[model samples]
Target: MADPNEPVHVTTTEARAGATPGVTRYVLGVSLVLVIAIFAFLILR
Candidate 1:
């Protein structure tokens, strides 16, 4: 058993391992734009 109140430390590299901020932002932006375009198209059709 481990201590319930023990503090755990984690480095930035370990915390963000396999994470890509730029690519994630790009994908999110593109998806948002596509969704808005689709809605606009439907509304204006």
Candidate 2:
């Protein structure tokens, strides 16, 4: 018989992989916003 704990581990792994793209997008968007803000500040100053 299969162990119940194994399924939980597998599900967690799948969930993390599924969220990778979302995390990457969030990071990229924040980076772009920071870059633009910095550039605007420099230009205005």
Candidate 3:
């Protein structure tokens, strides 16, 4: 794993903005879906 102190690099303008817009929103939506899936799996199991 990489150290947190090291600066990270990204290639997106939306990443710099950091708001939940455009590509950012797509990433967030996928993350939210994964979280919900895990929660449902745990509860159902």
What TM-scores do the predictions have? 0.69, 0.53, 0.51
Off by over 4 Å in 2: 1-21
Sort all candidates by TM-score, best to worst.
1, 2, 3
Single out the weakest 10-residue window by summed lDDT for candidate 2: 13-22
Error of 3 at 1 (Å): 49
Runs of candidate 1 with Cα error greater than 4 angstroms are 1-4, 19-21
| Order of the predicted models by lDDT, top scorer first | 1, 3, 2
Instruction: State, as a TM-score between 0 and 1, how close model 1 is to the true structure.
Output: 0.69
* TM-score winner: 1
List clashing residue pairs in candidate 1.
Answer: none
lDDT for position 11 in model 1: 87
Per-residue lDDT tens digits for candidate 1, residues 1-45, read 989899878988788886655788888999999999999999999
* Backbone clashes, each candidate: 0, 0, 0
lDDT of 2 by residue, 1-45 (tens): 888777544677676775444688888999999999999999999
- Write candidate 3's Cα lDDT for 1-45 as tens digits: 899999988767657775544687788899999999999999999
